[model samples]
Target: MRSRSLFSLLTLVGLAALLLTACGGGGSKKKASSSSSGQAGGTLITVAKGAPSGSPDPQINYTLQEWQILIISHDGLLAFKRTSGTEGTKLVPDLATAIPKPQDGGKTYVFHIRKGIKFSDGKELKPSDVKYTFERLFKIGQSPNAGTWYNVIVGGDACVKTPSTCDLSKGVVADDAAGTVTFHL
Candidate 1:
């Protein structure tokens, strides 16, 4: 009998919550609304307080909020599909021409950099930038998951220890002429 009474109380509370959520009544502040016109020049005011705590540097920022913004602005060798449900989880080539098959017993991966892609500043993207980016990530040593996720690269352990002199030459090799960046794990 006690369990039945408790269940009834829970059901009432759940219904109340659902009704309140549906009503959304409280403040008199008018909510901002937007319409799609397939054009730019509009204000997008997001009230996200306390997210993306640090600067917007890709190597240093590790929060989910930062990633959400960064993913839209940046492209990596590979990236997950930006879709809903299971399709979004699939990895696809972003800057690389195609995903290279793992070589040397799954210890090495060679990515052929996509040609003609330019940065926001109109600078051509190069394979050397990929190498430099990873090296900078280690050198900074501020990203939360750098050690856990990037330590698999060669010479990463030393970088984790001494960030000032972090070197990933053996780990990340960039051939500018060939337009390729190779990673040795």
Candidate 2:
């Protein structure tokens, strides 16, 4: 009777070990398979801002409708790469391919424009378009968002003056030759 009891106890222990191993292995495989399937991507993001002025032009104030239209309609040089906090801070890269950099004694700056981009009007974006856009911004007076470009480029201050003497001719220059732009301070 003692020998039979010992054999039965060993058999039960072996079975329990096998059951635990199988349970652990099974869970890991299921998790690995699910994670692989979840790697597919197709995402859209929604954001809200305090009342927008509705104008599509970032420089102009229109209405909330216009602001929404602009947000959807336009892209910038570089967008905020990320957002943080409860204020819903975000990364914003609009029309630029990369951040601008100064050259030639801080008087000249160059920017590389993103390729294969188009405007809402179906216009292909070129360095010239960027030149025109910045030119327009300067002509319109200091935008409320003036700080966006103020320190980034030179002549931003003069460009904001009323009946502005902002010498755009000497300031913003487009190098169609290289598909790059240069801003002379």
Candidate 3:
């Protein structure tokens, strides 16, 4: 009788352990499946602020609208190269085929533009566009939001001669002829 009782107690303990293990495994699997399902379909992001200052130009005010428009409109040298989102929002090649670096004196940086990319108005994005954007910011003396990114480029100060000239030099150059841009700095 004593032997039978001990055997029964051992069996119950083993059964309880097995049951707990099974429950834990099922819960983990369920959580993982739910998380993956949620992420499988891309996410939709909405901002409270309405459309920005109509101008998609980044040199203007860096408003919420402007930032959204830029992300939607223009391509940068190295876009969200370190982004934490979907393929579209992920940091990938944008206007440039690849991010270029300075070869000579760490001053002259060249960016190779991607072919066949067009603006909303059906205009091709050339290397000159990049150059013009940089120059414009320098001319503006401040970012659309009053920040200073223009100063980082070479010839930035020289580009800012007068207000009109400043506008011309506010952005980086997109040279159509060479299919690349060389930032002075």
Candidate 4:
């Protein structure tokens, strides 16, 4: 019992030390915010990173630093709340109307995307874009340790394992008129 208690205390100390190091340089900058500058053109926000941010592609990059930039520059179907609290971890719809309704015994998912969400190119986001986005991930297979999004879709594992032998369009359906994207798992 004594040994177990000592181990727990040591673990707690190590975790606290790591947390302190991570937050040590993240002090707030009062004069840099858009609110103070009165800039109406766009909002300016900043994030502190311990290391350089690499590629910003969601499929090509998986590091915490890359995700920080992606979250700011692009919209996901869902996003985490940006609070300085526990709620920041909770998922919220960014491009979609809400979390999708699961069907077919949790094997199918239908997402209703929001209308008038334009990309940087001024093109309105379409359901087909979602399908293309997902397909690109499998096609690129950026790194061996890529996330398993392809593994969850129907025939997606086969596509990732052997891209030449698979057809991604058969797995996802995008209805532009209905603003819906369906994933067949």
> Best candidate per TM-score, number?
1
TM-score of 3: 0.55
Instruction: Write the residue-wise lDDT of candidate 4 on 1-185 in tens digits.
Output: 54443333222212111111111112344676556456569777898887675664556656767656655655666666768789876656666687665566555667787787665445677888777766666677663332343455666777778765556666678899999987776
- Cα error, residue 179 of model 4, in Å, equals 0.9
Candidate with maximal lDDT: 1
Q: Can you tell me which runs of candidate 3 are displaced by over 4 Å?
A: 1-45, 50-57, 63-69, 82-91, 140-147, 166-174
How displaced is residue 154 in candidate 3, in Å? Answer: 2.9
My TM-score estimates for the predictions, one after another, are 0.72, 0.52, 0.55, 0.70
User: How much does each candidate deviate from the true structure in C-alpha RMSD?
Assistant: 17.0, 25.9, 24.3, 12.6
Across residues 1-185, which tens digit of lDDT does each residue of candidate 3 receive?
54343333222212111111111111122344544344557777664554346544455555555455445444455555435557544334445566454455444456676676655445676666555554445555545422233444445455544544553332244467879765543
For 1-185, candidate 1 gives per-residue lDDT tens digits of 54443333222212111111111113344775686655678887464656447876756655677666655556666666779999986656667777677677666778897787766455787788778777777787685655876676799889999988999999889999999988787
Candidate 3 vs candidate 4, TM-score winner: 4
lDDT of each: 0.65, 0.47, 0.46, 0.58
Candidate 2 global TM-score: 0.52
- Superposition TM-score, candidate 4 onto the true structure: 0.70
C-alpha RMSD between model 4 and the true structure: 12.6
Lowest summed lDDT across 10 adjacent residues in model 1 is found at 16-25
- Model 4 regions lying over 4 Å from their true place: 1-43, 47-53, 143-147, 164-166
The predicted structure with the larger lDDT, 3 or 4, is 4
